[model samples]
Target: MASREFKDHYREQRIFVNRTIAAVLVVFMMICVLAARYYYLQVVQHDVFSTLSDRNRMQLQPITPTRGLIYDRNGVLLADNQPTFSLTIVKERVSDMEETLTSLSDLIEITPEDLASFEKRLYQRRRSYESVTLKTRLTEDEIARIAVNRHLLSGVEVEAELIRYYPQGEDFAHMLGYVGRISEQELKNVDPANYSGTQYYGKLGVEGHYEELLHGKAGFQTVETDVRGRVLRVLEKVAPAPGADISLHIDTELQKVAVQALGERKGAVVAIDPSTGGILALVSTPSFDPNLFVTGIDTASYQALQSSPAIPLFNRALRGQYPPGSTIKPFIGLAGLDTEKVNTGTTVWDPGYYQLKGDDRKYRDWKRQGHGWVDLKAAIAESCDVYFYDLGYRMGVDPMFDYMYRFGFGQLTAYDIDNAREGILPSKEWKRGMKGLPWFPGDSINMSIGQGFMLTTPLQLATGAAVLANRGKWVAPRLIRTINEVEVTDVPSPEDVKVNQEWYWDYIIKAMEEVMHGRHGTARGSARGAEYRMAGKTGTAQVIGIKQGERYDADAIAEEYRDHGLYIGFAPVNNPRIALAVVVENGGGGSSAAAPVARKVFDAYLVGSTQLQAAN
Candidate 1:
């Protein structure tokens, strides 16, 4: 009241007008700020937001490429790709993983094992949105059932993928190992981007060795999806590149024959072309079906294989290590000649046993009543243990190792023979280093006959045989003749074995020929009536060492503990075509068990029954 009494009307009005103007300006500033923000969002950052929205609306899917076909040299299919339906769950797309897994069980037969494997994959999974396989190799009826219930299934997909198949399952099981789901451990070693959409990878054998060439680049597809992340329709696609179709040097018919020849017996046979250095036939018995592992083997079946006494999973040809026995005699004989320790006229008095000049301990020959007098030729033909014993003792361990190594012993033999063992060629340094003991003279004597620490794979034996067939020339043994229809040209050439005297080759070969053709040859029985002149050496290796005064009766011992029969040979002594090695486990004699198999293999290749057709 007091203030009103003294107030001027114009002044009060002016103050009210000023406050109203201040309010108006504040509102205008806010409007400007809002307009600026709207302009920036709509125009400047437009592409970024739109792209993010599209990413949510359209999903990128993976298109697995069709796996490459694997064929034998004769155009016979070894590995193939088959169309199979798999019921899979994308964890991020699924509303509830466990519930969907249960729901899918109703449409098809889902065993407890399937659930267990699914859980294992989840634990091993690396990336998100990756499909978890619930059931694979689905039947047509099961696929139809899943398709009919598609609307109810949110994250589940019925993907038809090309899986690895082996028509020649048993024959090529170990040769071309099957693909399997990539494990976390395996995934770590691979390029994650390349393996994206590809669930399986090469697990073992040739498949494992050439995984890079066999597994092609994965492709991408832009797919439209609903709000629930369900794929609606494909918008765009990048086609997957299929893996290379490779042709192995494996001769299909010869492989079949080798398998048939080895039937039910646990062993290995490897045949090679001496001129080409191509592995004509590589066979290992007690083989499994490669198809069994293609779709992930069942637990019971896998366990059965694991528990099998025969070890069907083992690759005997390339991996099995056994005492080479008399198969090594020819190499040692050659060493003797080259070192000038012995000559063509070299003769040894064999009274069925050998001894050090001062020691009395007898190293007995195979024949108790031994050949009285054996020269180089007779020694090799008769497989005279005493003669080799004498030769080896004089040659010493160093020269033996050097000579054997030149023939590809104690080392891997081939450029393409993957995972093959190099076998043991014992020497003074090796014995001192590995066994922490001095090399005994007795070790030399034993190694001379391919005993003691000496060991060899069937493959190495075959390679050595081929080298011998080549007359001191070295040709690297290999399984791959061509890749993707192109000849494998990158393989390294091995230097020919050094020979001081070139004639030494012919002399050693003549002795080997005598083993198959001579009257008292050990393998004469196996070589009877052969159309072509052949050269061979038979071997009998003891599994368990026989103590002094103890005798080895093959029938008296356990089958696994008996001798391993081995044979190395080549046909048509002059122009050797096929060189091979055969091993028969617990078999009595090389002539009876392994040599006959070699003879059969030689005849199969030389008889001209199966011709090599132009590789398709």
Candidate 2:
């Protein structure tokens, strides 16, 4: 029995040993297979794995430049860039954008317009990257609400973006213009490589003209990220170059005052430094806020602006072409003196109307009881149509064209800013070329009196008046005083601009001075309280053809048929600093309607605010 038990125990030990060896072999084979697979992934497929790792662990982000600031002559901020929170979406991370957007809409009131705008931006930005601008300029309350619900909206993100802010708002609309998003058309125009991170461009006025100077170079950065595409840390970065700040020649205070001075009237006022050609104020009434246009104006709003009867979108300062009316008389009188077509003492008999040789078109005088036997000085004072009518016929077309060209008429001022319309300086050649008709003697007669095909923009008139103030010296119309404290470059030399003659200008200046200081001067009553002598001309452009028996009275005529009042002047008569042009559409007389505006401008420029306060 003992021997049998010993044998059984030895057999059991052998069986246990065999089972232990088999289990160890099985574990060894499994380890070998896992090790081989690991080797294959780590070494043979290293590049693919490395690429996947980079996709999860690295990111590239754009660093946008700060937009340049705009300041007026007084250092008041006009256009500024402010930081604001915008909602964005990362398309790759978004599982269901419609659901995410729907939930986001609950946090903040989202209009169909907002959704439409967002979708447009999304398509433009594409899905591989973050798409901006679901909601912009979010309020504090909205931001708080979004933050609380951020976990619920997986793909939604709140990011900081720069937005354009026009602090002065509607005050500097035309001059400051506005900045807006870069459109596909604008993108095509811009070099994609250069503007990789830039988002806005100037749309008009000074802003549009200096887009390159205002939009600075872009920048970039390489960042390390986690597996979930979260930025971990910056690996490399290049700082963006900031945009150049711009200082305009515009005076915001004077601009404000001028716009206010217009009240509800539709008109335009342009004032420039006669010596330097710096525009002090350019006001076009019925203006709109430029900020409204910064983020792509809606079709309805844009249509309203376009269709408004006041034509707010029309740049009257640069493009409104109207017969200069009596404003052309001073220049015409000067032309006569320069061409030796008429002397200062030259006289023409006026019985309230004038008639050409065979043409029965009686060019009637504004004064039914005309000034009899009027000289050049007397004619300018009374604005005697008969006197100018006689002189214009004698001066003829070619000579008048040459002399008018000297006064910056019928030509674009070519001011530093673009979009200035060259007003019609209707010459015999121009009439013949454009209309394909021979120049008529009657056309010259009418043009001489600032009528019939003779048109001048507000800018052109301001420049011409400045030329007269400069005594035929340097006068180039300027809108930008400095670009980032750097004086504007390549300003045209005043000495380069050719004028009639020095003696002629002297005589004309004396005559214009008399128009304000002279006892019989038309603008004399308007100049009574001014501390300084103002050389000016009063003009009333006839809006309708009058019958031989009709008398013009603004109250009697329809509003559309009423006369346009115009005034062009320079202050302190002898040595002028500020030259201005004012136009009041359908505002009856230049002396009554336009001269006061010029006087106020003169008060702002020649007589400083301190002086006005002291006097007050």
Candidate 3:
């Protein structure tokens, strides 16, 4: 029995020895594999491994710079950046997102918009580890509440964002424009790299015109973070460069004066410094607060603005096209004299109406009882329709069209602003092309009186008046005096577009002076008692067609169907300093309504009557 036990024990020991040998072999092979991997990573694949390690541990972040401020000519801040609080979400750090969001909402009030906005941002961002904005312009109370409950919430954070705020608000809204959040369309159009750190861009006017110069370059920083996506420390930072400053040519004081002067009246007044094409004051009535458009405008509010009868959203000063009425008479008078159709000594007989040979339609004169016989200077001074009718027949439509084109009529003024419409300058060819109709003699007669297919913008009229005042020199109108801190010099005078004899300019200017100073002058009512000579023309354009035999009267017509008062003029007959144009929609009598507005603008501009209620 003892011998058998010994043999069994010996066999068990042999089996144990073989198993131990196999286990040792496996352990040696595992160590060899680990050693080989270490050699490959540390030596052969050093760069690849190092890069992966760095990416896992380090982060790159953008540092947005402060946007430059904007100020008016008088140093009043037009656009400014104010600190605002916004709630953001860090996607990667979030666990149980619904629970986290619920906890956050409990702390701070989150609207349906907040949740909708968050979902939009989540889909827009590619990286789950990245953070996006959930809400903007959070109230102070909301911020404090969120901060207190921050410990309960994960992946939620508050950030300070510089938001654009207009202190003047609605006052200079159209002129200054406003900035807003960039849209998808804009993202496609703009350089994503350049606008990476920029949240807002200028949309129109001065803001849009200088977007590139105002939007500074973006910068980045290296940061270290943990696996949970928590930034531990900033490794290296590159400070961002700020945008350049822009100074406008507009004077705030003048703008305010003009805005107030145009109170309650649906009209436009554009006044400029004649020496330079610097737009001193541009007023378009019923202007809305541009701030409303900066942030997303609500549907109700947008609809209200759009539906408003006053059309507060329209930029009438830069865009409104209207028949210049009789305002172009002075130019036509000049045209007539320049063409030698009517010299200074030329005279015409007026029998209260004008007839074209056999045409029974009497082109009636404004003065029903005509001033029997009048010279060219007297005719312009009195706004004699019959006198101009004769000149129109003699000068022909082609010559008149060519002359007016030189005066910037029916053409865009090439102002340093966008969206200026080129008012129509009708010709035989233009009529045939645009209206698909043959030119008529009656069209020529109407065109001669600044009517028919001819049209002009308020800006164009003001600029044309300036050119006349400057003695045949057209200066491109401008709203911004300087850009990117670089001062813009006076625009060079346009090459003289000869319309008439050089000596004829003197006769026309003298006659225009007489229109303001002469007893029979139609605009004499408003022109009287001016400190300096203001050569001007007053026009009452018929909004509704007058019957062949019916005389137009404001008291007899519906308020909406009444005539529109129009005035175009320049100050100081000899050394013209300011040129202006005023249009009052449905306001009767150019002398009583529109001329006074022009007088007020001229007074405020040239004589410095910033505060005055002079005779209307």
Candidate 4:
């Protein structure tokens, strides 16, 4: 038995065979597992893996559409798009932001303001991968320098883009407004999908009012990029739809004439086409260049504009609320005729002042020795305050408010542009609401002369004059004449201001005509040597309150406190074509300062029309 156990070679061979079988089974199991994983990755999840890989190498980039071109009615370019270079940075790609900014500062002339603005925008940015503009309107030399050092500067890029440009500069600043870097608030309001690549947005005027139409639909492109996120090639692209080119009712020639006419003065002039209610010219002097605002205006420049006494940024035409003065006389006269409170033949005795039934307060007239015994026609033509004061007392505040409201007063007249003020047409209700006081007979007296609580913007006055010129047919004023070659006819129609006597319009219009052509016309000097007949009314709005029986002494008052000169007029009285309103801030009188401005605008339009007619 011992000899048998020592020689057991078969047993050893059996053990070796079992070990070999176990090793083979383990190797086969591992191979099957590896094959299953390969199948899952290559076939089952192919699309998922492919997308992840593509995301790493390819980028979907937004292509900004070119902003619309703005042109005057005569095809004069007001706003245009110009090619500009901008330096941008992506925070995610950058190794160190401060280091990158420092390096860029060394390469280019980066002001402290630029750095501050950039840092602000960097914090405000939505994403780390999105490029933030560091500096705009980069020079050629700056671009070349950045390109040479591109390898060292990781997230920095110089991109060429189209920026808004105002060719008319300061002249059209307020009317066309200006585009500026999108603010944090603006970003919240804007459609992220549409404005992904757009950096600038309209801040004011027509630019703001028609921002949707001006900012075209954005497009996209698939770009092949390297590991460093540098674009290697544009794999596919979808061209962006350019913004609609807009044509305004503004006549550049007329605008220039109006601007020139208002030279060196703090004033506003608004001219409209009576037939179409198209704004021909809108001028607010002491204007600053809109170009300054396009690419983030520097603090110093902005401060200068903000702090200047002239108020260059103020849109006086649409926002300045001043007493209508004598300008509202014609409208008041219309109201009188409509209510039967006073007819065309109604007369009142004038002794240079008006008293409300035994009250000591004597509302003085512009003429110290007023036109003796004035009727409605002579009252408006001579601007006799006594007659209107009596008229206002008779009609009271309710009827006056009603009639004025009908003429687009105490409300927005031009719906086309944004920020137009609805001037105050002081009524008993308005006085109670605003000043918390009862409407007195004296209040009515003041309202009658276009004084106490009676306010009107230059735009409103022009719109009212147009209404009068159109013989009570109201047409809301508009700036946009056409959009993308299609004429815009969606302007709001005027409400019918019906009167008891239809001939009342003609009667008041004839009285206004006398104010321009009659011997005793208030604006007689302004109408001298006119080619065609014009209807007009002169006004002097007091800047400061005058005491009872106290004469308005211009020399005693501060320059800013001097009376504002105002005039409302329409040319070719028989068939009115142009209706205009002029206001000179701190000007001594309407006839001297404001009427001349109206004359210049009238001459430019009427003479130009005559020339065009002869040419045809």
Candidate 2 residue lDDT tens string, 1-616: 5555336888899999999999999999999999999999999999999987776777667777888888877787988988888787777778888898888888898877778877876767322454567777789999999999877776677888888899988778887778887776787787676677566788888789888877777778878965445678999998888889988777777787788777777788998877678888888887898888776677789899999988887778888888998888877887788778888778899998899878777888888877899888788877888988888899888877876787788776556677778889888778888999998878888888888888888888888898888777656787777777888867764344344567777777777888887988888877887788888888888778777777776788778778888999987777786788998888888888888887777777666676333322
TM-score, model 1 to reference: 0.93
> Candidates' TM-scores?
0.93, 0.88, 0.89, 0.94
Compare the candidates by lDDT and give the number of the best one.
4
Q: Against the true structure, whose TM-score is highest?
A: 4
Q: Write the per-residue lDDT of candidate 4 for residues 192-260, one digit (tens) a residue.
A: 878887889999999999998999998888999898899999999998888899999898878988999
By TM-score, how accurate is candidate 3? 0.89
Which segments of candidate 3 are over 4 A away from where they belong? 1-57, 90-105, 110-132, 226-232, 490-493, 555-558, 609-616
Model 2: lDDT equals: 0.80
Instruction: List the lowest-lDDT window of 10 residues for candidate 3.
Output: 607-616
Q: How well does candidate 4 match the true structure in TM-score terms?
A: 0.94
Clashes of each: 0, 3, 0, 0
- Show the colliding residue pairs in model 1: none
Candidate scoring better on lDDT of 3 and 4:
4
Write candidate 3's Cα lDDT for 1-616 as tens digits: 5555335887899999999999999999998899999899899999998988987888777766667777765566788888888888887778888888888777777777668756765665233344677778899899988888777667788888888888877668777777876666776787766666556778877777777767777777788987755679999998877876777667776677677777888888887667778776777887888777664565678899999988988878878888777888888888877767877778899998899987888988888998789988888788888888888888778888988888887777655677668888899999899889998888888878787787788888888888888888767778766666678885655566565367677777787887778887877877767888888888777778888888887788778888888888888888887788888888887888898787777777666753322211
